[model samples]
Target: MAITSANQLELLQTAEAVAREKMIDPGLVVEAMEESLARAAKSRYGAEMDIRVSIDRKTGKATFTRVRTVVDEEEIENYQAEMTVEQAKQYLEAPEIGDTFVEEIPPVELGRIAAQSAKQVILQKVREAERDRQYEEFKDKAGTIINGLVKREEYGNVIVDIGRGEAVLRRNEKIGRESYRPNDRIRVFIKDVRRETRGPQIFLSRTAPEFMAELFKMEVPEIYDGIIEIKAVARDPGSRAKIAVISYDNSIDPVGACVGMRGSRVQAVVNELQGEKIDIIPWNEDQPTFLVNALQPAEVTKVVLDDEAGKIEVVVPEEQLSLAIGRRGQNVRLASQLTNLDIDIMTEAEESARRQKEFEARTALFQEALDIDEFFAQLLVSEGFANLEEVAYVEIDELLVIDGVDEGTANELQTRAREYLEAAAKAALDAARALGAEDSLIAFEGLTAQMVEALAKDDVKTLEDFATCADWELAGGWTTVDGQRVKDDGVLEPFGVTLEEAQDMVMTARVVLGWVDPEELVAQSEEEAEEGAEEGASEAEA
Candidate 1:
């Protein structure tokens, strides 16, 4: 192949054709051609010579050049490409080190091997440009839905031809054993776009919860218009799904809009999901109320929520137990996911029995600690007294309100309760000391004697050890393992220490030990408060 007048224009024509076919910039193809031609020219000229090629974008004219750089006497390594400053004076009036001298050269007539090598170079560059173009086009399309045609199936994975690129729908991402043949049109959610060495990988999914949300958004005009918002979605893939929605407009019912007139809208989404049943629930700011709505078709007798633990207990009628829990606990599982809380569902009868057991336990505790008779202990338990501390420190009027309890009786009960608590505290402190607990830890505020004993048993016997503990380590927390939340038992958790209280106690210890500056802590807190206030003001203004 020669860069003659006849073939000079052909170079530009071929570059534009390749660029158009690859959907990449024409300048990139031209640059690739220039590089390939330069490589061939180097083969014709000395390999050490710096040969360069340039193509005129407008005139389609090819220009070839030979370049040599002037270097210091000791730096001249390439005899054909580099010359010493003194030797370069023959080619220039004055040539400083690092100065390049360029001379026009005739374009090389590429041999069969050279032409083949140049072709491979151009192809490699074009493929790279194509991959970059594809990546840039689809990166932002992630988290969206796109229509594609199935190309083939490798193992269980299906490859789809999306207009300019091919995406893979992994086996796990398919809904309920969905099988597609070649040319089958499929709707999929672009779950992710990743740029790899080979090319951009567009992962498609039909089982994602967001897939259902996007389907609903496409089907529901109110959701698309932002009048009704999809707050949360939980899906069991092709089995069942729960969607929580809220409506900003009072006149518009979010559930009704999602369900559509005569189930037209929701039916469309259901059909696309291969008959997955959907429960549209109205979103509520209160978690319990929202959970009640989420557990539909079952009557809830009571809902007990432990906000600090992110757990909720739902008591349902015995007849509705199976329905609330669903088949194989699917209903409760989806509800838990929708509400972002751990749910423990029980029958009304079970809840009542548990409550009675708690009452009896509290009554027994009062009888033993206060040295009272069964009847007197029962009376205390019935009046909302759970422990000796409450009975000892409660207002005299609160104890007086109990039946047949006078001022003198209340005084005696307080005295007995306080005496029992002091004895228990003394015993716990003695045990902690026996286990090598230090006085520095014992005198620390906030921690009970029993907490110190618990810490001592766990080998935390000093203030420094206590300060080294993380809040979660001291107050317990939930861990996610294999998609299930597991409970991590904390040392002070049994002592009723909350996570926030544990954090404050640890920070207090650090400050007392001079490990942290109190003034800096105060300044950081104030700065955080100001940032929060500014955010609140901006949101309110918006």
Candidate 2:
């Protein structure tokens, strides 16, 4: 097409319409048109010549020109692109090297093939602009709820047409029982927005716990207004779910508020999730109480907690075990996830049997180790004394709290406990010394007698061996063994050394063996060197 003055306004109008439909800046569309026309002009006027095209934004008047730089004879690598100083003088007076000259060329009529190429270029640019607009619009919407229409289905994934963009709901992220047909309206959680070569990809999810939380926020005014907070959520998706909530206001009940009057609020969320059962429970600051609430509808008789191991043992009535464990252990599993603790559920009968066995074991230990009668051992065990260390380190007042345990008996028990521990420690120290342990390791200030023996037994008998051991082996950290990272109980586990004590012992051993500080060695070497130099000078003078 020949761009005459009469049709220049038509060209500008067409560029504006394309930019409006594609949601791109009008200026960018015009720039793309200029580039297409420039490529066409190069076909007519030798491709080797430097050519540029500019279309006016207001009138769409096209301008074509050739560009050449004035250079010395030696710098003229391409004669078509560069003109020698003498040749450039013909166009103007005394044209200097490095100066550019623009020669105007009349606009050429585009042929059929050239017109087809220009159309393709404009479409490509428009598609790129559309992708950029979609990314900018949806990037910040991730982690929030979005409403869209089902556009199509690919394999098992659903493509939803969100206004101004399209998003994919992968099969794994969809609720197992949910299905969609084209043009159906759906709400989804914007999981992520990624910029890819093909376009901006928006990933949506219906099964994420956050999606349920956001739905509650929309339905419950208390949650949205910050009067109540959803502390945690656990979902078995389309089957059952649990949410723990706490109220900041004294008059408002978090669980009741979340359930709403006659279950209106929670039922709205449930209907959206296709009849997923939800249990809203009040959250407690105390862990055991929180766990008791998390396992709702199941009565908990007792809870025993091990904080270090992140475990909780819950005992329920025999009739309640099935309910507490749920089908395939679902209830306890969800409770574990909601509280972030490992939950082990058992019956009251089982816990009582285990407790009795433990009491008998402790009674036997006290009778044999302290040389006490069965009655006296029973007395100690009844007072909650489980080991000799507690009896050895506990105050006499603690023992006096027991009936029939007078001051005289308390002193005698403590004396026997001390004597037993001292003898045990002395034997351990002698054994470590006999095992070829270095004196430096044996005398390390922080190592207890038992820790030294444990090291010796493990063949870490030398100063270098102890120094080279990893902090995790000496103290407590994660250690990799056979491609797995496992928590190190510490190399001194056999001796019952605590993690803190093990760390201190490792630091002391390194310091004593001179593995940590090299300044002293450097000083000693310098002193020896100076002394040798003085001795050599004295010998020469003599």
Candidate 3:
């Protein structure tokens, strides 16, 4: 019955006062008024009389308007279509036959039931609006700070008072091992704020990895300046954590800055986090390098990468393995997550054995060539050599001391050794050749023209460049050239280079340049000034 601005304001204030006193949303009370008016209007007028109510926000009041259909009839007073032109003279405008008439019915005219109907309509609309409005106000507040009062603890979950509402702080969200009692004041992060018609569903978490990230941002000034970046973090709440940080400025050591003097900077965060053990490490882009840093306080000797499997194998001294792996592998576990690498820790003894197996395989292959086992034993017995290692690495002069092992035998043994080496090298080169291009040859710098020419041919292209014959071909041994035996002095005195120098060229050529050509006969032939000089000297003597 009261459908005016003044009436709406009074109703709104009344609802606001009620909501404030009870700590409930005022919109809910407004909705109840709207529903009350609707039912009342339906009971007084027919249910077909659609009723609407509007409430003023500034006041605890509302207005209710009743709408009805208009009908034109000769003499019917019900549902009046128009007032006569004579009767409309009260206002400046005169009404026509087809025009509609509108007249304000004062509150005094509406019965008690009609006023009740209006109130119901106003209340229902307010309740619906409250949910939507509340959601908007809180959703943006997620990931922010909030002040809440501990309401009650149901089992272990703590319910909190958030101004006009209550939020649940599940036991897991509580920092450290802290316990909460009813009416205790607590500060919590608005981890998640969700809306339901009943109320908002706020999700609270204290064990998420981001919890540590937020704690650092709160305490560290460097983080706000963009100078420090936390590259990664892994945490086990109330236990231990590992975080990787990097600094844009070289002058600032990222880990050192985060650690602070006597670890004060991180300790602030730790204390807030309730004394969680934290280890800060410098972040590295390189996997091997990053893993080494991640396994800190325990020095690492080597890191083997298996990128496809996303795993790394690290080697530390036997004593440090326990330290690197930590208590029940906690250190390595956190490091793995911090570096995002699956880690397998090993001790030095395991690595040493692996290297030993590799070395023995290579040595056996060397002995197989040139019947080196038998040749070495004979040389050792004659020259008083004890082991194979000495003979294998002996100088040419030392080889000469061994009886029955002349330069010819030495040269043949050396060539066989070179060919065996070439065969072994080809296996490794084959894999590289697949992944390499023509520029692969460009890796060579100090190569000679003769050597490059050998690499140019298809059959000898790669093999010739890798062959170790350059020294002997340039040396004094006479070898059959196309079945034609060509012999010369083995004296390298003319070249002023030793066998060691020749050996160096072969090894370098095979690794850097790929193929090496056999030594070409580079001997310079010179004839005596002839016997004419001798005849003149003889005449002078006579």
- Top-TM-score structure, candidate number: 1
Model 1: colliding residue pairs: none
lDDT of candidate 1 at residue 402, scale 0 to 100:
87
Top candidate on lDDT is 1
Can you write out model 3's per-residue Cα lDDT over 12-98, one digit (the tens) per residue? 777788677655678777767756755664555455544555554565444556643333346435433234545545643644555
Ranking of models by TM-score: 1, 2, 3
Deviation (Å) of 302 in candidate 1: 1.7
TM-score of each: 0.88, 0.72, 0.54
Tell me the tens digit of each residue's lDDT in model 2 across 194-264.
99999999999999999999999999999999899999999988889999999999999999999999999
The TM-score, computed over Cα atoms with residue i paired to residue i, of candidate 1 is 0.88
Tens digit per residue, CA lDDT, model 1, 154-230: 99999999999999999999999889999999999999999999999999999999999999999999999999999
Question: Cα lDDT of model 1 overall?
Answer: 0.94
lDDT winner between candidates 1 and 2: 1
The local lDDT score (0 to 100) that residue 513 gets in candidate 3 is: 43
- Per-model CA lDDT versus the true structure: 0.94, 0.87, 0.65
Better of 1 and 2 by TM-score: 1
